[model samples]
Every structure is written in C-alpha cells, then in structure tokens.
Target: MKARKKISRRKHEVSTSNLIRHEVIGLRVTVVHSLNDKFIGISGTLIDESRNMFKLKCKDNVIRVIPKEVCIFKFELPDGDSVKVDGRMLNGRAEERIKMKRRKVVWPLIVEKQLKKARFQPEICEVLMFDP
Candidate 1:
C-alpha cells in the first residue's frame, strides 16, 4: 500500500472573535464602497483612524480621509481570512467597540425555558397545579 501524506495543522490558531474589537491601525484594507467619489476604490494601509473617519496612506504617499458612515471595508486577517465589514458596524473606536452591546433578539423558546425554570419553586408548582 502507498503511504498517505499527513496534513499538518498550524500550532497556533488565530482567533477571529477579536477582529472587530482589536486595533486596525496598520492593516491594509480596501474601500469597497464610499459616498465620496475620491475614495470609492482606494486601497491602502490604515495610517490613522478616528471615531468618525479613517486616514489611508494611498499610493504616491497621498493621505485620504474617508468617512466611516459612508464606506464598506474589506481586509484580510493574519490567517488569510478575508472579511467584509460594513462601515456602520465599525463606527466606534477600537477600544470602545469591545464595550458596545450587540443587538440580539430574545427567542420565544429561550423565554419559555426561563419561565419554566422560574416557576419550578414548590409553592409556585402547587399553585400552578391547583389553578383553574
């Protein structure tokens, strides 16, 4: 029988959970969309960022400021994972983004489970059993 080639995995796994929360100061990114005609298709290193805008050092050493609200960005992670993120989702500072609350919907099933656990007391169970 022929020997099979063993596939080796990397020793360290890259975590993508912190991608949105970590500082993106030096990451190379492309502007997938922009409201301003000048920055619509710019690709450059993120030299600086603020709560409202990002400054990209484009080719020819030209610095362009683009509003965070009017653009979509695409960047690659260290592990070669390409991510496309909306500008609105990245509106806040990197440090503040970690504290931002994500919008979640409370499912009926989860609410039902919580209600069942809350009503598991003996006294509540007796009342529930005798209730007309």
Candidate 2:
C-alpha cells in the first residue's frame, strides 16, 4: 500500500485595493448642491461611468462633471443644513460611506440611525481615483 501525503491548507491574504474596489450593483448616489447660475438647492442623482468625472441628473437636467476640481460644494439638509462634500468621480457602486468626521459614538448605533434615516443612502458613493 502506498503512503498518503498530508495536504496543507494555505491562507491567502486579501489586498487592500481588492477590498476597496469590491463590486456593488444597482446602487444610486444622492447629491445636494447649488449651481453657479440660478440653480439653488440643486439635488441630483450621480451616475458613475468613469473615475475622472460623473454625470448628475438634476431635477430637470442632466450634467456631466468632474467634482473634485470644483471649488465649492454646499448642501442644505436638516441635521446639518450646510455640508461641504469633497466630491470625487468614481466607478461602480460604493459599499460604504466615507465619513468626513470620526465620532466617538458606537458605530453600530450610528449605523442604525443612518439606516433609519434616508438622509444618506447605504452602499453608495465611492472614492474616485484621479489617476486610475
């Protein structure tokens, strides 16, 4: 009888880039801002087709743009009616929200509150790469 060889299991580590670029489908983006012209309280849905720039469907208009290059961005929501979002164009659907401010509160509770409120959509908005 031939002796059987012991099989070893090797663990492969997942890279950070792979983790960050995880795939997401059917995700939508919500943007609140003011346009240079007569557009105030400009709200729109962002479309991710590229990294440099994305398209926004305003109330009754469609505009393609590179958000990072824009100087000023403003929002008028209830909690913090005024927010300056550092906009960036990205590809695919985002699976997490990049919080601008890090709080000491529990993440789970905060996440629950976020889910309860529709102020921010879950699993949307991604980091746009400038040189990708």
Provide TM-scores for the models: 0.61, 0.29
Give candidate 2's error at residue 91 in angstroms. Answer: 11
Candidate 2 structure quality by residue, lDDT tens digits, 2-101: 9999774321221222222332111233443322223324445544434434455665766645343221233333323333443432222343322122
Instruction: Give the Cα error of residue 92 in candidate 2, in Å.
Output: 12
Give me the runs in candidate 2 sitting further than 4 Å from their true place. Answer: 1-42, 72-83, 88-132
Top lDDT prediction, candidate number: 1
In angstroms, the error of model 2 at 88 is: 5.9
lDDT of each: 0.64, 0.35
Backbone clash pairs for candidate 1 read none
Poorly placed runs, candidate 1 (over 4 Å)? 1-16, 103-132
